[model samples]
Target: MSHYDVAVIGSGPAGTMAAYHLAKKGISVVILEKEMLPRYKTCGGGLVYRGRRRMPFDIESVVEREFKQINLYFTGDDKVLTSLRDVPVISMVMRDKFDKLLVEKAKGQGTEVKEGHKLTGITFGAISTLHTNQGDFQAKFIVAADGALSPTAKLAGWKETRKLIPALEYEVEVNAEDFARLSSEVRFDMDSVPHGYAWSFPKKNHLSLGIASTRRKKIDLKIYYKKYLEKLGIKEIIGEKAHGYQIPITPRTDGFHRNNVFLIGDAAGFADAVTAEGISNSLWSGELVAEAIFESGLNPEKAGRLYQQKLEKDLLPELHTSQTAARWFYGYRIIRNMLLKRYGDFAMSLMTDLYIGDRSYPKNLMKTIKGKIMEIKNPLM
Candidate 1:
């Protein structure tokens, strides 16, 4: 049996980030990926400023476009455009190239990336054993970064408790006029879908248009996607097909670690409920798990506890705050519109700060929102 210090399942940003850090620290790490390198991943591919700032290496080579402003449209004529002036708020890149670049960086740091190796089973002992299509391997620690519907977490006896939201993305090749017009800014239409939103992220030669909803089973995403495209005046430019996937809207409340096994990124349900942004949290969690393992001296029990402590102190609090804010922001449309109409710039600035890691979601967000609602009701106040 091939033995290593850590075994990471999946080669997305989360898994690669963990493996890169671990291998750089001289730990033997192996990444098992079910698909071959550079496989297409269906995503809007917008890397927000927060996620970009957290990356250890420059991803300039993979970045296709950068935008300094975002346009938020609530209804037909209700909209707000927030500009960062000199700071780019989001960078766009195709996932296939982006993910491959991260994996290559990990490889340079000495992590063994075993492509096309799907993990079939896992047996726990003093040292956990991962049964894969390639072969069985042993490791002192296991990191599951597979994705929203994580097989590793299920195999490890963890329950599926996080809320899974549906999303659809289309890569459309547009004419010069539309491409040039849309490429200058990122646009989001909140009223396009029920309890969800539609977004347009511009890449080098195409636009990644997507719609997502937190409300389960009640939405026809395809119908909404068509409406969103028409609303943007680009329905005719849409490609032949659209890709769909599920995103975890919250973190796992039970726990993130069991024995020597740790779940990071979507596997641990780390995507933000408000924005549905996962790359930043995914990378952050991956780095944290690696740090915990190193701090624990490869002791699984100690590492698990340390991981939980780090999560509660740093990541979980933000996620919880976002969850509360999302409930209010999406639940009451009238109140939400009122708040947005009155404080659109302030709201957008707060969100921008959060995305750039300059600020966190306020712990007393609900109270603040309630106060705002009361102020709106009493104009004299």
Candidate 2:
């Protein structure tokens, strides 16, 4: 069987980033993907500004639309709050094109990308063997970036379930006029996407809309989404078909590594609990794991520990902190509106940074709390 220094399963952000970095380090690497190139994925396709930094270069060429504002719709549309940022802080993208771009970048970096190849089974030995349709291959190290229901994680015997939030999303072609009005702001409807939120992200000639939630288990998403569209005064559906996927609301903290295998991204449950955004986290984790492996001589346990330590110290703590704050957020409308009105653009930008993995909400929350405490201590002054 053919052997490589590293084999990565999945071609999503995590796998692509891992392959790219490993290849850049002069390690032989191969990335296996189950889908054809540029295949559509179920996503809201909103990328916040700070998270965009993980990419080596600007991805504006692949961006579908850019926006400078965020509109928050609370309990009632009458009490809407808006925030505007001077610079474009968000962009709407088509995942098919976006993911394909990164995968191509990996290829350009000399990482072998095998498309349309599904990982069937993995055999563990002195060198782990990955069974794929093209053929069987062996590797000294394996990176499982295969998403939430990862087969690689299972093969590695690292199984940890998480609290999952169901999400239904769609990208639709709309009137140019509507698209123009939508150009600089992302619309959020809290009423319809209860427990989660419904979002409308504008593209050049289309609109991306979707709803998600953890509480609405067993509820009919299509029916709920149709009702949501009605409330928005949208009478028609256009563009691509609606698709649904699960977002792991609570990430697994078990440290995903066993034998010669390592897990990153959704497979490792690194998606942020509040926004369900995983792209940047995936890339960050992938890079860290690759670094750990390279430094540790591919020792699974040491690499896993180092990866987890770095994650907890650098990232997961913030997510865990956000998880607590997100609970307080969905509880009532009054507090939410107050925060929107008081914080305004700053809050929205902060959240954008948080979602994209640039800033930690928990860290900011403490600062806010500290500021308030100091204010109370010197009230008269």
CA RMSD of all predictions? 1.2, 3.0
Worst 10 residues of 2 by lDDT: 369-378
**Residue pairs that clash (backbone atoms under 3 angstroms), model 1:** none
lDDT of 2 at 60: 86
Would you estimate the TM-scores of all the predictions?
0.98, 0.89
Candidate 1 accuracy as TM-score: 0.98
lDDT, candidate 1, 147-201, per-residue tens: 9989999999899889999999998888788788888879888867888889999
Best by the TM-score measure: 1
Q: Which run of 10 residues does model 1 get worst, by summed lDDT?
A: 232-241
The CA lDDT at 187 in model 1 is 86
- Per-residue CA lDDT of model 2 for 172-272, tens digit only, reads 77555555655546888775756777888887677788888756367667777887777666654455578888877667756667777888888888777
The whole-model C-alpha lDDT of candidate 2 against the native structure comes to: 0.76
